[model samples]
Target: MHHSLFLMGAPGGGGNSSVLLIYLGLMFVVFYFFMIRPQSQKAKKQKAFMSNLQKGDKVVTIAGIHGTIYKINDDNATMQLEVSPGSYLKIEKSALSMEWTMAQQKAAEPTK
Candidate 1:
């Protein structure tokens, strides 16, 4: 009985519970700021990019296929990509890689 009491902490002091609550709150805040916020912001950007897509916009897919947006099917969330002259492929909007597409666009730009 005495050993259990020692393990459980002081019966009269409530400081430990308060401190634990504070620590958990701090951890939640840290996780939100460092992980959740950035991810949601990135998702918003990706959604906006996908929504703003139009025909003739060149893009790179997550699968590394480079093509131009030939047609957008809003109802099914798919698009037809022109991979080459007279060559086309159907793909999902979500398959587009924002990072690779940005990089490809940057490479296509003329450097000053």
Candidate 2:
């Protein structure tokens, strides 16, 4: 007589399922903001930097070669990296490092 069966109409049974779904949704939102959103924004910035490559701008390649942009062959997606005066190495625009270039620029600025 002490034993009872939990039926489909149990008071708390349905409540937990909705709570679990809400918790999962909240976790996805958190990950989207913290991880996915920043990654996408960074990719956009990198793409813009790649597209805006110009002659006479200094850049460092991802492979650690630093040089001034001698010529941009947008027709072929490559650039001539002049590591020294009249000396050049042709490489892809994608090989440039945006973060390194920004750091070098920051270091070159005079502090008041």
Candidate 3:
């Protein structure tokens, strides 16, 4: 009877389980901070850049095509881009990426 009682009264193996749960929770927090937050921030910045596009702004498309904006049809979700003199292409607004902020800065620099 005392042997059975001793076995029943022994502490259950819950300490390891609780430690595992704590470890998993910490891993999730680390992943969110390192992997998820920066990506969301980049997406938000890209969305803002796309929304602020205007006519006559130079932009580079996602396919690496560079052009100047000839027209903006925000209602129709399209824009006309002049890739070269006397050459033009109609592309969706989403196709444009990475506005030429650095290019503009370079142009504004005084030539040596």
TM-scores for the candidates: 0.85, 0.84, 0.74
Per residue, candidate 3 scores C-alpha lDDT tens digits across 10-104 of 36854656666777999999999999998899889878877788888888787888888898875758989999987999998888665454465
Give per-residue CA lDDT, model 2, range 1-112, as digits (tens): 2223223234657855666677799999999999999999999999998878799988998988889999988575898889999899989888889999988778878998
Cα displacement (Å) at residue 98, model 2: 0.6
The residue-by-residue lDDT of candidate 1 on 1-112, one tens digit each, is: 9755554455675655776677799999999999999999999999888888999999999999999999998675999999999899999999999999989999999999
| Ranked candidates (TM-score, high to low) | 1, 2, 3
Q: Which stretches of candidate 3 lie over 4 Å from their true place?
A: 1-12, 74-76, 99-112
Best by lDDT: 1
- The local lDDT score (0 to 100) that residue 8 gets in candidate 3 is 47
Query: Model 1, stretches more than 4 Å misplaced?
Result: 1-11, 74-76
In terms of lDDT, the poorest run of 10 residues in model 3 is 5-14
lDDT of 3: 0.78
Q: List the residue pairs that clash in candidate 1.
A: none
Cα shift from native, residue 19, model 3 (Å): 1.1
In model 2, where is the ten-residue run with the lowest total lDDT?
A: 1-10
